[model samples]
Target: MHSSTLFITLTTALGLVSAAPTDKTYNPTKTSAASRTTHTVIAGRGGRLIFDPDNVVAEVGSIVEFHFNPLNHSVVESSFDTPCQPKDADSFFSGFFPVREGQSDEVFQIEVKDTRPIWFYCAQNNNAHCQSGMTGVINQNFDRQEFSLRAHKELAAEVEGPSGVQGGIQGGWRIPNPNPLGGF
Candidate 1:
């Protein structure tokens, strides 16, 4: 009888261990309000094919908001090795945002899930924006000088064409621009 009791206890403990959540699971709602920060990144502002403040160091649970300016542009996630191509099908992408003047009514935002670097670029091929040096990075590893944003941009210059997903992916969010006039 004692052996049976011990067996049951071990089984229950094993079940609990198996049910434990892993680091891969992220629940945005559970993140503390005080720990959350919003980093603004302007896209193609002032008719320039660039992401103002192109390099940002954002913590996990923080949001990187990409505000689109006049003309059309998009933000697509890519890996450091492949600068202009989408990192994967699950990568985050902000579908093209076109504005005649001023800024777009919407903004693209992605939450930082980990400290690893995230490379992105504008997939606007009409003017070859990505090839022209429209790229940005999030949480870049400063210690690795060889894998810097400048190097990524250089690699992007060599790409024949930059490509992106059909539309926005699951890893990003597109919400109404809080400041359409470029305030704050």
Candidate 2:
């Protein structure tokens, strides 16, 4: 059962990753032709990618991406702001589950029309990163939506967490490294 979930997760990742890291900047997104690709962020490697720009607006054929940092997480396109519990098994998100961690899963190329509102969250308890607001937008195209995202921050205000974790940083239960690595 574990391997099966991993397989489905890997299949979902390949569907989002783009060719290369497009222009990494704010105020102005990549206008190049290859910008159609996107990176779907997930848990693993480290923490996770927070809303650096906090929010972004994309056109019809824009490609976004999500990468794993130093945390164990997944970008499940379903609902439930929690983790593992997939609820968007409908037509759009069904069979489109891609998650990666510890290693590269797959690349997910955006194939939606305009305004793709994908809600992703980390399924890590004891750390409860998502409950602490670890979500962002890919190629969302709307003014009102940007304003709506503001709630994600307050959404976790009641969450008993964030002792040593930063806002954009990942916060989840993890085993301490027995061996100390020289460098990060």
Candidate 3:
């Protein structure tokens, strides 16, 4: 290969590696006690298409554990401004988990990269989950009830079909259902 071509390829590879090093992995056992809380969020609990609590506050090193239950549901990252729409293809997404009735074995664990408020929603396509206000946030300082109310209104204007980005950020972990019926 030409020297110039080789140099370009190496530069691009190194840039990708350094862009988000902190997003790679975290050992909770090793993390300080002050930054190691684990917050749980139930998805589709009680057959209702909503994230239980719908709002949370987590520190930079905390873990957000999402438990999927009853029928099918998904977790997709979004922006407070967009509400129901996907923030970007590269953003976090817990693909449709084909959870059995009364069962809740599937869980997705995402580590917080910063203390910034992170917004997300259920991208269930068979119903109007997002429009029904199936959204949530972490580390938000504002009133969640008010934000949820506005999100419902925004979704009412137009509900975009959920984005198809199956994988999420560099450090996010997921246990996807293996059944072919499990929408990946």
Off by over 4 Å in 2: 1-54, 78-87, 91-110, 139-142, 145-147, 156-184
Choose 2 or 3, whichever is better by lDDT: 3
On lDDT, the stronger of 1 and 3 is: 1
Candidate 3 C-alpha lDDT tens digits along 1-184: 9998898799897884345467668656665446477787888878887788677878788889888877778788877777666677667887777777754555778888987778888777733777777778887756555555355446533765553444543336776433323332
If both were scored by lDDT, which would come out higher, candidate 1 or candidate 2? Answer: 1
Clashing pairs in 3: none
Better of 2 and 3 by TM-score: 3
Comparing candidate 1 with candidate 3, which one achieves the higher TM-score? Answer: 1
Better of 1 and 2 by TM-score: 1
Give the alpha carbon lDDT tens digit for every residue of 75-103 in model 1. 98999998778888888888888888888
Q: How many backbone clashes does candidate 3 have?
A: 0
Query: Which candidate number maximizes TM-score?
Result: 1
Model 3, residue 134: distance off in Å is 0.9
Candidate 2's displacement at residue 134, Å, is: 0.5
Q: What is the lDDT of residue 88 in candidate 3?
A: 74
